[model samples]
Target: MSSTVVETRRVFEVKNLDVYYGDTRALRDVTMDILEGQITALIGPSGCGKSTLLRCFNRTNDLIPGAEVKGELNYRGQKLYGKEVNPIVVRRRIGMVFQQPNPFPKSIFDNVAYGLRVNGIRDRLNERVETALKDVGLWDEVKDNLKKLGTSLSGGQKQRLCIARAIALQPDVILMDEPCSALDPISTKRIEDLMNNLKEKYTIVIVTHNMQQASRVADYTAFFNAEALDNGGRVGYLVEVDTTEKMFHDATDERTRDYISGRFG
Candidate 1:
């Protein structure tokens, strides 16, 4: 995996991105800029395709049979899905952490070392694992249990472990899909704080259903809604994307206001 590109600007500038799963459309012509060193949140109701857009950044959605993407998605000014682009290489630069804490059925140390091992990093595996665990605020608790199975940890600890795993890969950006939906309130708050701290070094994009969570940790928020079409599937659209404060306080779209104010999902 490549380290952060040394720059002083946005890492991603998505332009008129459209996604289709065979004959059904998943995302509309969505355009947004994800600034470096900031956390961007995607919030929408269930089945609204918030996760679909997130997957586009790393081209994960393409793995779905018949799924296709249209328009430009630039990363560091380079088109992400360009003909010469390799999805495996793209994923290396942009790592993803899913909703559940899915650590390998190995030792805690090995869990964090998996990425390093795959990338042929061997000189300082212990040090890197320690650094990532410390960053996720789990080092002190599990330092003595490095040899213990990762599955032995509690729910909160497991989630933090997964986060540590993501960071251990040292990707330029981290995409999180409902990272805290399964954890307790305390765990969720800790993860939120971790995200705030991680923004100093990582560009974070999170897909969350919790509006309050978006308001709390995101600097920018994109609100999405889906309209069920005559065909059987739904089509997702971006209603508004703005600074979190502005979107939450003074949204120009009536639909955005209604959704944010809890009038409708």
Candidate 2:
């Protein structure tokens, strides 16, 4: 039997990525490389397609009606949108955590086990769930209450449970879309800590509106902008891409400086 752990290289490399919703183009010629085992944060004002670009990594954009993608999105050297690429398979290898703490309504155990079961990872279910929960720093707290409803847990735990759910699949990269926007400061801090710990094992890409949060968790940062076209459509553009320090402290673009300095967004 093949080992469940698949050895993949460099997580993703995007080139000239353009996304369109019907006749409206949302993203234009965006390109970047995501190294394996690092956090790359996408930050910008609202409507910059920060979330849209994150969805592209795992081909989540394909689900939208009238949505189309142009250009190369390579995952470990394989073209993600290639004729043979299956989105379900892609999603299994690249998990996503959303803005809200969206834990399933089932028991915590079931919530974590759902992915494994669907993917035929059933033999060591309990052991794997334990390891995953521990990886997200939630094992001890919920060890005795594995059978409890996921909703019964606090907001922080629910988000962690979502993280556990994503990691249990052993994905190559995990995509987070503003995972902390809904949490308290304490909970947000915990999730940020979890992201740091998770970096050693999984490539992380987060889309956030909070510039401070981007600095805290992102190793590489991409600053984006949205252009209001005369046609009443918005086009997302990359204003700058650099290390978190350089982008925040040494930004070249006036817009980036303005946004970071609280002067304007």
Candidate 1 residue lDDT tens string, 193-265: 9999999989999999899999999988989999998988888988888889988999889998998899998
TM-score of each predicted structure versus truth: 0.95, 0.95
Query: Tens digit of lDDT per residue, candidate 2, span 111-222?
Result: 9999999988879899999999999999999999999999899999999999999999999899999999999999999999999999999999999988899999998789
Give the whole-model CA lDDT for all candidates, comma-separated: 0.90, 0.90
Single out the weakest 10-residue window by summed lDDT for candidate 1: 1-10
Q: Give the worst 10-residue stretch by lDDT in candidate 2.
A: 1-10
Off by over 4 Å in 2: 1-9
In the order shown, the candidates' Cα RMSDs to the true structure are: 3.7, 4.9
Tell me how candidate 2 scores on lDDT: 0.90
The whole-model C-alpha lDDT of candidate 1 against the native structure comes to: 0.90
